[model samples]
Target: MNWIILILAGLFEVAFAFCLGKAKETTGNEMYFWYAGFLAALSISMGLLIKATQTLPIGTAYAVWTGIGAVGTVLVGIWVFKEPAGFLRLLFLTTLIGSIIGLKAVSSH
Candidate 1:
């Protein structure tokens, strides 16, 4: 259950990250909406992270949460934002993913 919540938090973190850029891209009313969404997502993500830390090791939980968010945000950047996806970037991303998996495997819960 905690893991599920943490994953949702990570997804929201990714959403907020994208919303940050979208907010910057727009003007006036549109920017306000995006900013509001970013704040909401950020709040939810932080709350879930705090909850997950109650059971999971803080270091492992934080690493996995940020790992998910980082990987997700990177994918969004490459696909939706039209950012460059060079070989080195993908390689490091895969490495980070491997580390996340390793952390999960070693975690007792």
Candidate 2:
């Protein structure tokens, strides 16, 4: 389904962000490799987003896509990059997840 595609696209967006983070922490060939991964993930994410938009409303799809990317990137930052996971941050993340669900539920498609 397009929703599944959209979700996958969002995941790729997170992957691209992860790649960028990793690239930032590395050097030389390793940095270049991470940048390559970023490019690949970015390409796939955009492609799937374009596909999903064929069936889903553009506004809803974009919001959900970015929401998923934001949530996933934050979690990745906490788990992988050892970033802060304070109370307020988690609270906002929960709300964002709820909003994404609400958007899906209210979508005409």
Candidate 3:
């Protein structure tokens, strides 16, 4: 259950991070909404992640949470924001995902 919450929190972290980038691209009222919501969500998610880390090992929890958030955010940035989507991007993401899985396996025992 706690791990589930941590993963969900990480997803929210990615969402807020994307919103922050989008907020920077916009102007006026929409900017305020995006920025505020992004910051609020980001903070809350971090808190939840920290709470989760109390039970889970810091290295494993942080690695998995951040890896998923970063990978998802980059994908979103590529598809939605038209950011670069090249082989290098895939390579790095793949490595990070593998590392996360390895760390999780080691931590489980």
RMSD of each: 0.7, 0.3, 1.4
Query: For model 2, how does the per-residue alpha-carbon lDDT over 1-109 read when each residue is reduced to its tens digit?
Result: 9999999999999999999999999999999999999999999999999999999999999999999999999999999999999999999999999999999999999
Give the per-residue lDDT digits (tens) of candidate 3, residues 12-99: 8888988988898999999999999998888888988988888888878888888879988988899889999899888998898898
Give, for candidate 3, the lowest lDDT window spanning 10 residues: 100-109
lDDT of all predictions: 0.95, 1.00, 0.86
Candidate 2, after superposition: displacement of residue 4 in Å?
0.3
**lDDT of model 2 at residue 30?**
100
Candidate 3 TM-score to native: 0.90
- If both were scored by lDDT, which would come out higher, candidate 1 or candidate 2? 2
Off by over 4 Å in 1: none
In model 3, which runs have C-alpha deviations exceeding 4 angstroms?
none
Each candidate structure's TM-score, on Cα atoms with residue i matched to residue i, is 0.97, 0.99, 0.90
Clashes of each: 0, 0, 0
Residue 18's lDDT within candidate 3 is 88
Better of 1 and 3 by TM-score: 1
lDDT of 1 by residue, 1-109 (tens): 9989888989999999999989989999999999999999999999999999999999999999999999999999999899999999999999999999999999999
